[model samples]
Target: MQESQSLLATARSKLEKSLLAKGLRRSGERFAILEEVYSRNDHFDAEELFQAMHQRSYPVSRATVYNTLDVLVDCGLVRRHHFGEEDNSKSRYEKSLGRQQHAHLVCTVCHRVKEFCDPRLHLIQTNVGNALQFEVESHSLVFYGQCTDDACETKPTDSSANTEDSRKTQE
Candidate 1:
């Protein structure tokens, strides 16, 4: 909890500086949106964020939510992701401040997202950058497949067959 609070504080300061640099008004609505975003642990869309704000008794317009998200993304306070080809139009966002770089696993059936970090991935990035003589600042990797959770909306009738089929398709 203390760590989260400190992260939020740092994010607030960054947002303040960004807004000032852009000559934007330091409004309460923007701060409220930031606080709401930092309080969550899931990737969310702009509509979900707007609804969340209303649920928290802080009514703000959809436009405000969308515009604020754009500002946050620009200021590096938020990370936007387009997870799968099927949902190219829907963009999901997560707070980026004080968070380590990670990869995502997207459930094609349920559209659920899971995040993981692997040191090998970083090492591969470094090696590839060195080999290509290119500076790799960052990378985004997403693995898309059906999740095996019981609550998933669409579950394979035969897990073994499904796995085999997935492998064949990949190959």
Candidate 2:
């Protein structure tokens, strides 16, 4: 609990600094959105966040949510991900402060996202950068397939459905 509180304080301070630097208003609604975001561990879209704000009785507008998300992304307070081609219109976001760089495992059938970090991935990045004499600042790697969890949604068994799903996943 103490660690979580400390993290939130640091995040809040960063957001304040960013808002000031960008000449954006220091609104309580933005802070409330930050708090709501830091309170969650899942990857979520903007609509889900707006619903959560309303569920918590905050009642922020959809535009506010979207704009705040843009601010957060620009200020490095959040990380946005484009998981698949099928849902290119919807982007998922996660809090980035006090967190290490990680990769994602996405379930195509259930559309669930899981995060993982592998030291070897970092090593490989370093090795490839050295080999090609190129600077590797960062990377985004996602593995998409069916999840094994019992709660994961099952894929349609029909041949046409399978073909369509496979095509989407490959994109």
Candidate 3:
């Protein structure tokens, strides 16, 4: 999306091929939207993405954005989340599916977001599935805490209060 346009070409080819196989129209803007999302490092909501794309004159519509996102979800290319009831029907989208253990930290005070990766999630999923004899489909874990300007340290048996204090300084 940023450079040699080949990235866009490859992504478009894959998306179009996938969509065509399902007998769906490969409407023009969806590929652009997917390329933008895949090439970026930030999480986004529909309106946020639409505004940003419109500012860049990407020829995108809100409906197409949402539709493309649904397609991405179906294709296992993106994950969606509902952060709040007041989110105006816009869901947060993140980039990932496999080999990724993700957790989020939220500030109810300011609604700030933070993400982390933990490898132990796979083991947890496996154990949970084994315990229930139900195959683990997918899982999400989010931890909420009040974040202070200076340092806020809270751990969940996770007796890393001191370690957390050190990490907060980086923020």
> Which of the numbered candidates is closest to the native, going by highest TM-score?
1
Worst 10 contiguous positions by lDDT, candidate 3? 149-158
Per-residue lDDT over 56-136 for candidate 3, one digit per residue giving the tens place of the 0 to 100 score: 789777888888888877776678876653564757887653325677877655656678877798788899899999988
**Candidates in descending lDDT order:** 1, 2, 3
- lDDT tens digits by residue: candidate 1, 11-113: 9999999999999999999999999999999999999999999999999999999999999999999999998657589899999998898999999878889
Clashes of each: 0, 0, 0
Please report the candidate that would top lDDT against the real structure. Answer: 1
For model 1, the run of ten residues with the poorest summed lDDT: 152-161
Shift of residue 22 alpha carbon in model 2, Å: 0.9
- Model 2 TM-score (2 dp): 0.87
Query: Over all chains combined, what TM-score does candidate 3 have?
Result: 0.73
Provide the RMSD of all predictions against the true structure, rounded to 1 decimal: 4.4, 4.5, 8.6
Of 2 and 3, the candidate ranking higher by TM-score: 2
Q: Show model 2 residue runs off by greater than 4 Å.
A: 154-171
How far off is model 1, as Cα RMSD?
4.4
